[model samples]
Target chain A: MKRTPLYEEHIRNNGRMIEFFGWELPVYYSSIKEEAMAIRQKVGLFDVSHMGEIFVTGEDAEEFINYIITNSTFQKEDHSIVYSLMCDKKGFAVDDLLVYKFNKKHFLLVVNASNADKDHKWLLENRKDFNIDIQNRSKEYALIAVQGPRSIELINGFFPIDVAALKYYWFAESTFNDNDCLISRTGYTGEQGFELLIHRDHAVRAWNALLDKGKNHGILPCGLGARDLLRIEVGFPLYGHELNEKINPIEANLGWVIKLDKECDFIGKENLKEFKEKLSRKRIGFIMDRSKIAREDSVIMDQEEHRIGSVTSGTFSFCLKRSIGMGIIEKKYIDIGKLKINIGEKIFTAEITHLPFVKIKN
Target chain B: MVEVQDSLLYAPSHEWIRIEGDIGIIGITDFAQSQLGDIVYIELPETDENIFMNSAFGSIESVKTVSELIAPVNGNIIETNEELAASPELINKDPYNNGWLIKIKIEDKKQIEGLLSPGDYEDMISGGNE
Candidate 1:
């Protein structure tokens, strides 16, 4: 199993290490629910070094990225990040990623750790005649996220640049403890936060520094378990669960990121246009009546027990104090208000609700 | 740092039974509850329901995963813990005492002899050869 640079730090902090996608990472340091609540109320830090970072640099980098992703990168300013999905020629999702536009000649793609190899292969397969160089920088950098309502308080003045001045979705190249790094106001949690990308050699020092400085602000080290629950609460589509090679962005309720009529044609524009016009399945959130948590692949049925779709993700939302989940259901059956979820031999009643089980002010 | 009571008998699957006359008070061990993390929901069999040894009686759902509650011995469910429906974290807080799942009327006294001793159960969990 692959180990991150901060593996020893995690061990020292008493993190319960577990195998995740062939990587040994911490599931939680203290408790999963408590760590999640800390992110919601105070502040939390996470070792996101397992995420992949691939750099695309050359004269035609912008044009190459535009043709690869569904979202239009035409007018996106430099140092800004755009959340988009990469789809295959058949309009199904290859992977969902964040595109960091450093400039017209240089761009960075931060992708899921599980999809790193597959995404790199896809990028190479589509690099037919573009004058761009694709470099997989997954091992060169480590990612640390400081997230929550009090995240700004903990991050401000830590670097030479005014971190508070950094706008949302924008990044600034700065030095941390004399090490070159990039600080971006981006995170998976809905709360305010920043994702700092530093060299792998300096990650352990930076993590310890942040913990020491954040002692007064009540910052807790979180794990992948809490991170998963937090994203589910915010209705973010996980790559393998809510999306895959067969599920398109339109079916996953991510159509807002796809721009079909852009000046530069993308790989899946034509098929995506057809899918947009004839939508079939739609992703929706539902809340269970009781504490019966609906898990992934739990069958969804109508009042008469007719099959509609199945659950993509589910968990007990610590903030809402109830069970919530997202599922891809037939568009025709989404308005039935209440649906039945089959878990084991028992059937649970779920009330259809909008995406995001909880509301975030920021 | 899991606690094991010397007076109780343990199942291989981590359920513990405190024998009191013909009534066996059954609940999960400390190691089992800790492994499951924060318990959010628990499904227990109804009162008077017949349950067999080594069969799944219900389930326990945590934040990230779900685990089936395996029965340790054949018996009739005389009473099920009702408080866990609203507050399932009780198992995480006190798995041996307030977190007891069910009270069963033992069908055969010979079945109790087959259960593991507290020391053996502790050894199995602590990576000792059992």
Candidate 2:
């Protein structure tokens, strides 16, 4: 399996390694519960170098990207980032990504690790009349996400600039450790954090430097296990589980990113407009009666044992001290009520609840 | 920490059976609890249920995954651990003594020889075959 630069560091820290998206990534260090709680209370760092980074440059970069993605890319200024999804002709989501407008001619798209190659091929095949060059620079860059409430304090301790002034979804290119790097105010966890993109060779040095500098802030080396739980707790959608080629952006509750009235014809606009008017499946949250957590692909059933939908993601939420899950059910079964989830031979009773079961008050 | 007395017979599945007269008190080993990492739910088998050797009696759910509890001996379960139905973490906190899963009436004394010794079970787990 492919290994990141911090693979040795993860082994040294006694991290349990698991294969994720063809890459050997750390699942946890001491315990998943401890690592998850650390991120919620203090600062935590993650080695997210496996996420794909594709560079789009040339005269027609913005126009090409705007035509492909389901977000208003033309309105975004340089050094801004917008969460978007690439859809097929049927308005079904291929992948959800972050489009970074680096400059007028250059744009970077960060995609899910497993869908990197597929997304790249799709972009190339659809680049029929657009004048743009797409380059897969995933192997050239390493990403680190330092997240939590005290993340700014840890970052400002080493960097010279005021990171607090950088608003959300904004990025700036700066020099760190004598190398040029891009720092962005974006993170998956629902907290104040930054994502740093640096050269691949300097990955270990930057990771160790941050660990050394942020030792006092209780910054621990988190892994994909904590990352999944944190994102789920905030009601964020994972690509393969919550989104896929069969589900559309509207069904995933990401309609805000789909701009249909922009006066320009784009891919999947017509189908999405029709879907927005008549959505059949809706995404909702469910809370299990006990700690018997439902998992992805588990069948969601009504009181009469009729299969209405399926669970997309489920886990024993540490913050809520119960089991919670997200599911896509038919609109007929979308009422705010109770339901049953079949987990193996047992059927767990669940109540239809709002997304984000645990809300952190600011 | 629960005590693992020398009088108890250990199973490779990390279950320990303490024979008291004709009754056998069963619980998971301390090593099993550590490996499971925080038990969240325990599904206990019903009382008076006949369990076959090496077959699944019930299941234990943790934060990461669920593990089936294999019956170490062929016997009839007389009593189940009712308290664990509400507080499953007792299995982690005291896997040997207080977290006992059930009380079974031993059906055969010949099955005792088939079980592993403490040293043998320790060597099997520490060999890192899992």
Candidate 3:
């Protein structure tokens, strides 16, 4: 199993370690629900070093990346990040990643750790016609995320960079305690937060410094469990569960990121456009009326007990204090409303709700 | 460190039984509650429902995962810990006392013989955390 640079730090903080996609990481430090609520109310630090970072440089980097991603980045501003998906010719998703356009000639792609090698190989095979130099920098950097309402205040104590003014999805290159750092005003948590990409050797120092500086701000070191719940509460699609090789971005409720009007025909543009026209299934948020908890792969059934769809991600929401989940249901039986889910022998009544089971206050 | 009541009999599934003749009070062990993290919901069997030995009676939902509550002995559910319906975190705080899950009318007293002692129960969970 691969252990990140923060593995020792996690052990020191009494983190409950678990294996996630070959990486040994913390499931939770204190408690999952408490850590999640802390991110909403105060501040939380996450050792996200397992995330993959790939650098694309050279003259034709911009043109190549635009064709690679579903989101068009032809005229994107510098220092901005765009969430996009890379799919196959049949419009099946390979991975969903963040494209950080550093400049016209350079870009950084932050992708899920489990999909790192596959994504890199996918991009490498498609760089034939474009002048680009691709480098896998996943081992070079350790990512840390300071998330919550007080993230800005906590980061200010370390390096007083006007983070409040930093627009969302934008990043700036700066030095933190004499170490080169790339700070991004982006996070999976739907709150005011920042993700710091620092050198691997300097990760421990940054982790200790953040915990010390954030002591007065009610900051706690969280784990992957809390991060998953935070994302689910905000209706974000996880690559494995909500999206996969067989899942299209349209059915995953990520059509907003796919640019259909871009003049340049991307790799999956034609299939995606056709899939959009025949979009039969749609993703949605739901709350189980029964006290029963729903989980992924739980079959969604109509009132007549006919199978309609299946759950993608489900969790007991700490914010709502109820069972909330995201599921892809058939568009035909969606109006039937108030469906039932048969986890096994147990059946639960679920009411269809809008995306984002819980709202994020600005 | 997990707390175990010395007088109570335990099941390998992490359930503890405090027997008083035919009536047995059941709750999850401290080790089980610790493994479960913050308890969000405990689906308890309704009163007068039949519960079988070594079978799933209900489920316990935490923030991350859901685990089935296995019955340690066969009996009818005389009463459930109604307090858990409103406040499930009590299991995390006090799993051995106020957080008892159910009270069952033990159909056979020999069922307690199959349970492990406090020392044996400690040895059971000495393996790595799952």
Q: Give all TM-scores, in the order shown.
A: 0.97, 0.94, 0.96
> Order of all candidates by TM-score, from best down to worst?
1, 3, 2
Residue ranges of candidate 3 with Cα displaced over 4 Å: B127-130
Candidate 3 TM-score over all chains jointly: 0.96
**DockQ-derived CAPRI band for the predicted complex in model 2:** medium
- Top TM-score model: 1
Tens-digit lDDT track for model 2 on B1-130?
2344577788888898988988899999888887777677788779999988899998887777889999899999899988897777788878877889999998997898899876677666777543
Query: Candidate 3, which CAPRI tier?
Result: medium
lDDT of 2 by residue, A1-362 (tens): 98887888999988878899799998888666777787788889999999999999999988888888888877778899999988888998878899999886899999999999999999998998888899999999999999988888888845556777789999988867878888999999888899999999988999999888878998899988789888888889999888777667888898998998764677888899998999999888888998887988999999988999999998777767788889899988899498999999679899999888767653
Candidate 3's residue-wise lDDT over A263-323, tens digit each? 5768888999998999999888899885557889999999898889999988888788888
User: Model 3 Cα displacement at B108 (Å)?
Assistant: 2.6
Question: Could you give candidate 2's fraction of true interface contacts?
Answer: 0.42
Report residue B57 deviation for candidate 2 (angstroms).
1.0
- Tell me model 2's lDDT, rounded to 2 decimals: 0.86
Candidate 1 residue lDDT tens string, A1-362: 99999999999999999998888999999899999999999999999999999999998999999999999777989899999999999998888999999899999999999989989999999998999999999999999999999999998877999999888999999989989999999999888999999999999999999999988888899999999999999999999999976567899989999998787989988899998999999999999998788989999999998889999999999789899999999999879999999987689899999988877887
Rank by lDDT, descending? 1, 3, 2
- Candidate 3 at A304: error in angstroms? 0.9
Deviation (Å) of A324 in candidate 2: 0.5
